[model samples]
Target: MFRLGWFVNYGFGAYGWNQQWSGNVAQDVARPQLFEQGAQILENAGFDYLMLEDASVLYDIYQGSFAYAARRGLIRQDPMPLVPLMARATKHVGIIATMSTSFYPPFIAARLANTLDHLTEGRFGLNLVTSSPHAAAQNFGHEKHFEHDLRYEMADEWIRAVKALWNTWEPDAVVYDEANGVFADPDKIHYANFQGRFFSTRGPLNSVPSPQYHPVLCQAGGSGVGRAFAAAHADTIIAADPGIDGMRGYRDDITRLAEENGRSGKDVKLLHLISPVLGDTDEEAWARKRAMNAAADADQTNQLAALSYISGIDMSTFDLDEPLPELSDRVNGHQSSFSVFAKLARSGKTLREILKSRRGQETVELVGSPQTVADRMEEVMEQVGGDGFLVVMPFTRRNLTDVGDGLAPVLRRRGLIRDGYPYRTFRENLTSF
Candidate 1:
């Protein structure tokens, strides 16, 4: 059976806010009840994990105005506080929270990860991101974001420092010997004294080791430099290539990079990101997909604005009907994302056409009834080899029900996914297959 995970915004962005199926989520965005409920639903469906995607900037890049992102609720709240709440709601399912290496200090991030691991009882994972927005840098007192590869370079050092902190206390460091009046074995703890070009940290992590020792490292680096960083350190990688061939090539490349880094391909589990449209019947599902695309086509500016916010380019300045000029070298935000758009442009696609077809750019498409969708997913895994899929979708009760109560049953019956978690820790369950 393949591993399964769900990727969702932390009710932060316009994740079905004010949409017909959203219910009271928009009104309850500040509360934890909705997220807690969503976690339990995924857990009951036997998902391996629930990952919360986050961004720290109120984007104004699209048209040099923050109004667009603000009006659409594109600005995000911090996702850190919600990790323990969701973990408390689900016993087996893992809860992963996003944190940017660009902003967080290595020691602070390591300490928080340790604390969350204890709170979640080894069920916590941290998704590392090299933030891709100039606006985010401004908030952190930097005039501009670090250059693309330079940010990954910093992240590489950042992870090393964090790991050093995590390993400060040996596994046998904690021993409660009441008779001898000893709380822990002080000799077992050692200083990190880590120093690097971007960051430096001294001494052991104050918090003791939690359940997993080091919480599972998750990364979503799609660029060449990013892939190298993830290959060396990440336990699980979130891949968003568009098709099976691209997905296979990405996995193979990562496998090669892992071997070069002195680790086996199995050390890094790659999960392809997908958003499958499903219904009771095949026709209904296809119709729903068409409607979804039509809605996107009607709101081209909003789509482009979201893309522009991440790519750090004001796409509103470009001619929508003409193919884009080469802009990959100029992008300071997300080079991998810009590379995708540039590739589309090189193929003669107009900005308007690319925006219209952007629905599946972030994930592969699977549209059909439950059985049909499951069949396609099984075939995809077989073609791409092992590992699994991470489902990305709008956070609405209706959408959750469609996947958890509707499609999940079909997948479960077919034995395409696990019926329950066999291991206590998330890393164990994720690598169980």
Candidate 2:
């Protein structure tokens, strides 16, 4: 059996990228303290990890940067820094940060992850994203984003190189031979001379080996290139889809991919993004969702955010009250956009209908009481053969406390959720497949 995890879907730019493309939820709706509070809430509730996505460039779902400042700012914090802050607040849950193999060098990536692993006491995970969109590459001084297939090809080698650097310092490399005044055993240190199509890295990283060895590798790509990268290196795969059959297909596809690459079903864990609308009863849950929907100015903000992040479509071009225009395949490479738009067209949804699909991306939304929520979760797990789920809340900690405080108990009652974290490290928890 696999464990369940939650995605921290709150905080700075929680709804969308850039200031102009907000969910219209006050700019300062959540602060650092609140983020810290959320970390505590999820950690205490037995969440496996919190993901912090990284992007070098900020654009609307349409991929435009013109309205970035008008929106607010591209993003607030450098995502890498958030890992340590979150790690300090939680004892057992993992800290996963997104780092692009396209921009950062292998040595730097390895050292940063290793440092976080040490700081987090071995509760670190790596969400390996191959940066897409030309703007993202331009920010990093590249002329253009590498083609999709090529990016994954580079990522494959990048993973091996980073792992080699990480393995440079052996488990017993640090030796406090006080009598001899030797702090490290020279024999335990090795050099990683890695040369690949995209990079040539030479290293013995500044940090020593962490308990997790290679921090739990996570992949958030859903494309062919993305799937290939995940199969090769990912320990956990993040996916967003609406139906149980789709989740199962994705799970099985990745499992087969892993096996073809010489790994097993247990080697990689599959997580579905779950945005839950929870209440005491089914009717109450539906009412709460309606209230949240009513409170949110979904039309302008949601579509704008979607256009900016998913496709390069300009939200301002479309009328807020009007039905969504039949959009062309304008996606720059992100698969999530296509999925969202497809849902809109397939369901014969209007612009508002699509915008109101789910506040937090197009992940399958479960609306019901705690028992209903847990039952749906079990169905997704047992019937779909899913490893776990990434619980995405509709609003802040105030609006949605039921996932942990309410639904988790129901899961526990059915022997689905663990009573307490049974492992010390992130890998140990995830690898118990």
Candidate 3:
């Protein structure tokens, strides 16, 4: 059977309300409590993991909530801090935190991830990211984001350095030789003075490695550089484009990339982001989607929020209801977003038309009854060459409930999803190893 995971777009009740600039909804929502509830739902539904995207800065749409978090001194909470808490609250679910290769130091990054794995009893995962957004650079003291190739170059070396550090402490390194008055054997550890195109790091990490070797590596870049990175390192690939053909093509590409590098295609699993809108009937589900979209809108003041959110080019210059010109070369950040935008623009779609097509363009949103949703999911898996899916909830809670109550049972009956987790580590659950 295929594996499944939830992509938690934290905040909002179940399909949260929109916020103005500088707002933080986490405080008002009592986020930790909601997170516990969300974790329970996903674990009960037999999900492999839940990924919390870590963004150090809140953009304009989230300004109000962001300001609230800062005022209450709640900004100190890193997304990874919630992982262990969630792990203790649930038995089978894995926890994944996004860590950028572009920012954090190698030893620190390895220690943090290793510590979480030990705490979670080996259910921890690392979502390696080469930070994309240019604005993200400003916050980190850089003038602009590193060029795409250079960023991946740094990431390649960074991974090599960390892996060597992780292996420094062998499985039986800690003999706790009290008789010899030595807690560890010095020979068991070695330095990783790795030098590459972008960075040079010396190591043996601060902490001992966890039982799982290293946490599962998940990646979500889809450009030339991104694919190369994923092929070389990731155990699973998360992507935004959820179309059957798109996913199949991506899977084939990654597989080919992996093989060219002397690894099998099975080394990496493909997960498509599926946003399901469930109801007793298709029309009812459609109605709920329309309502959710209407509610999430910033009262039309920022009708182009989605556009601006995806493409940094600021669609405010274009008519809200009109099609946009090809702007891939002009946009910043992930190339997949640019590719999607370019495809749409090439199709001669108007802005209004493109916005309307948001039904599944952003993700594969299945609006229908449980049977309908299950059938569609199965079709995608069987036909699209997909190994699994990453579901993006419309609103955090509601998305969880929909999948748990509506889709889970259906998928379970079809033998598509497991009734319970069969593996312990996140990597084992995701791959055949």
Highest lDDT model number: 1
lDDT by residue for model 3 (161-230), tens = 7787788788777778888898877888878777766666677777876968889998888888889899
Error of 2 at 174 (Å): 2.3
Top candidate by TM-score: 1
Error of 3 at 391 (Å): 0.5
What TM-score does candidate 2 get on C-alpha atoms? 0.87
**lDDT of each residue in 1-433, candidate 1, tens digit only:** 7878888854344467667676765565777777888888888888888888888877788889998877877756678888898888889999888999999999999999999999999999999999988878889999888888899999999999999999899998999899999978999999999989989999698888899999998998788998999999998999887788889998999999999999999989898888889888999999999998888787787768867876877889999889887766447776666676767777778888977766544456899998899998898899998688888888777877888888888889988888998889999998887
lDDT per prediction? 0.85, 0.72, 0.73
Q: After superposition, how far is residue 38 of candidate 3 from its true place, in Å?
A: 1.2
TM-score list, all predictions: 0.97, 0.87, 0.88
lDDT of 1 at 92: 93
TM-score of model number 3: 0.88
Which window of ten consecutive residues has the lowest lDDT sum in model 3? 13-22
> lDDT by residue for model 2 over 1-433, one digit each (tens)?
4466665543243543333323344543444554566677777766677776666666644424446534554454566676777777778878787888889999889998998888888988888888666877888888877876777888899999999999889988998899999999989998888878778878888777887878889888787767878988888888886677778888888888999999997798888887778888999999977876775653356446645555545666666556765665435556654655655755656666666664555356688998888887887688887688887653355533567778776887787866667788988876764
